[model samples]
Target: MIDRRRVLKALSKYPVYSPPFHNSEAVLSRSEIAANYNYFLEQKARRLEFLASYLRHFFVELSLSPEALPALDNWLLRYGGHLIPNGGEVLFAMNDYEPAWVGEYHGVNIIHDISIFAGDYIVMKNDKVRWSVNYGDGTKRDYEEIGFGQPCLVGLSHFAYTGNYSIFHGIYEFCYAGLRRLRNGGRGSKWERDIPGELVRRLNYLADPDPPPQIPVSQLTIDD
Candidate 1:
């Protein structure tokens, strides 16, 4: 479990700033760093325990196997489509024969980390994204809407280009506090009370999530 105090202590030493996602260079830089990422991925698995015990509703797992690549790939297309730093470096490409996700999930966090310090690393990071690059499919629920990671990724992008980490603080406060509330059985838990069973039911069916058909009692049959 990530000690709340640790996350809080890490966050306390920062101040907020207006996100620089509007600046073309910053957005492009964030994506570029995210795309060709290669570090600290193993750290993400540390979050799974807390997520499972405290926020079991959102916990979903994908068993890794060389043969199961197709399913993992398909799920990635939907989960990834827009957030993929590289259009071609699909999830499978990032993994090998290792039977675990290892550090794969850490890429975004690495991107998040780099986006906070005040500096421009993109020139060396991705010369191709020299000025700007358009992203997302022009819809209400694009990447950021999909998860808090996207916004944190952008917030760090804002911090990196502008030298401020408060954007990280505000967004994280909302997400973390919500998680804490659910953990402590506090207020604002109506949604959690309502959706966990449904989430587990659906996730359990990840291989093929088809709804069961309804039938009248008269049609029911017992097997001996």
Candidate 2:
């Protein structure tokens, strides 16, 4: 069981940010020089814990058993795509991974985090990323090269909201679906490879040119 009070208390503090992310680079550097070296480390651990607890809270609230959830480390190692800093927000690769973080910016509390799902068919063509389409607005954007650990927003995302269980549940279902597909010898797309099940139904849908027409049961001829 997660302590909601603990999470809320942590959120009450000023958010700490660091390198390979947004403004955290400076924070990390400054802390390393001025503050105790362990200060940043402590902050990092706190952030990870709060985020994990936040997700766990939702899992329980949605009636999902704790056993049904994978360990955070295992989950991230398996499906964690990449983390990229966008302005003041950090974007996570997988759908259900987004967690709420409270930070102080210019004397105000700000929540920073996001989740991005790329296109099903995005590919690199001619030294440029082709087939990249915004999953939300359907707009297209091109990128020459994506940096390591940087986010590519060639798809849609639900940005910076207190966790929504329905969305998480949907992702969980896709992951479960991917597992079932894997058991049946189906391979997922590059993005789906880590999390597997998202593309199974989509691929099946695309494979069939025409779906059988529906007929009313009353119109069926009786064999007997």
Candidate 3:
């Protein structure tokens, strides 16, 4: 087992950024821009640490093995889901477009989910099971396989409804359950309000946490 505390501590060193470039013409120097970009990259690097720590906690809490956790991590990263790695195998699924999430453990790519929407979730298998419905006229859908360790990615649009509340709530619930299962063992309570502060803090960092890489503005020679 990896040392959770060390992992978190290392992750803390990773950088976090706000914004350095506000306007198009700021009259900034190359060194300054480079510095800012470096800061941004550092922040992203730090996020990787945060992700690793969260995964460790989630795994221990759920009594899952290290092997099982990586599969979940890959799913998060490949699909643009945020999480970081400690000193383990790391792998990434790549494309011209953003992945739904990505995961890495012991430097190996274990899970990947590629989706376009925010309210998307991946179904791993088709077990022919009857799934419960929360809204959308109380309709139920059956699948051949649903869970983890089977498919590289699954779409959740099939579960969407017509109403905004139903769509948002259902998608939120689906993501929360998927995340919880990936790290923690159980699902969170079904609340129609906002997520808790702790979760928010973690997620906020995950969203737009890193700065942009610096580029040499002087190298450009525009032809008029």
Superposed Cα deviation of residue 35, candidate 1 (Å): 3.0
Q: Candidate 3, which segments miss by more than 4 Å at Cα?
A: 1-16, 23-32, 41-45, 60-70, 73-224
Write candidate 2's Cα lDDT for 1-224 as tens digits.
03324334444544434332332222213332233324333453454444444445334221112232344323332322212112342222221112233231211111212111111111111122222211122223211111112222222222221121122222333434444444444554455434533333332222233424445566675532
Tell me the alpha-carbon RMSD of every candidate.
17.7, 16.6, 21.7
TM-scores of the candidates in the order shown: 0.25, 0.24, 0.21
Candidate 2 lDDT (Cα, whole model)? 0.29
| Model 2 pairs in collision | 17-24, 18-24, 178-197
lDDT of 3 by residue, 64-160 (tens): 2333333443333222112324322222111100121222321111111111111122111222221222212222331111211111122222222
Tell me the TM-score of model 2.
0.24
- Residue ranges of candidate 1 with Cα displaced over 4 Å: 1-25, 29-135, 138-185, 193-199, 205-207, 212-224
lDDT tens digits, residue span 1-224, model 1: 33333333333322222122222222234454343222223323433332223222213333222232334233222222122232232222122111121222222222233222101222223222222222444555433322222222221222122222222232222333344454565444444323223222222222122324545555675421
Best by TM-score: 1
Weakest lDDT window of 10 consecutive positions for candidate 1: 93-102
Query: Judged by lDDT relative to the true structure, which candidate is superior, 1 or 2?
Result: 2
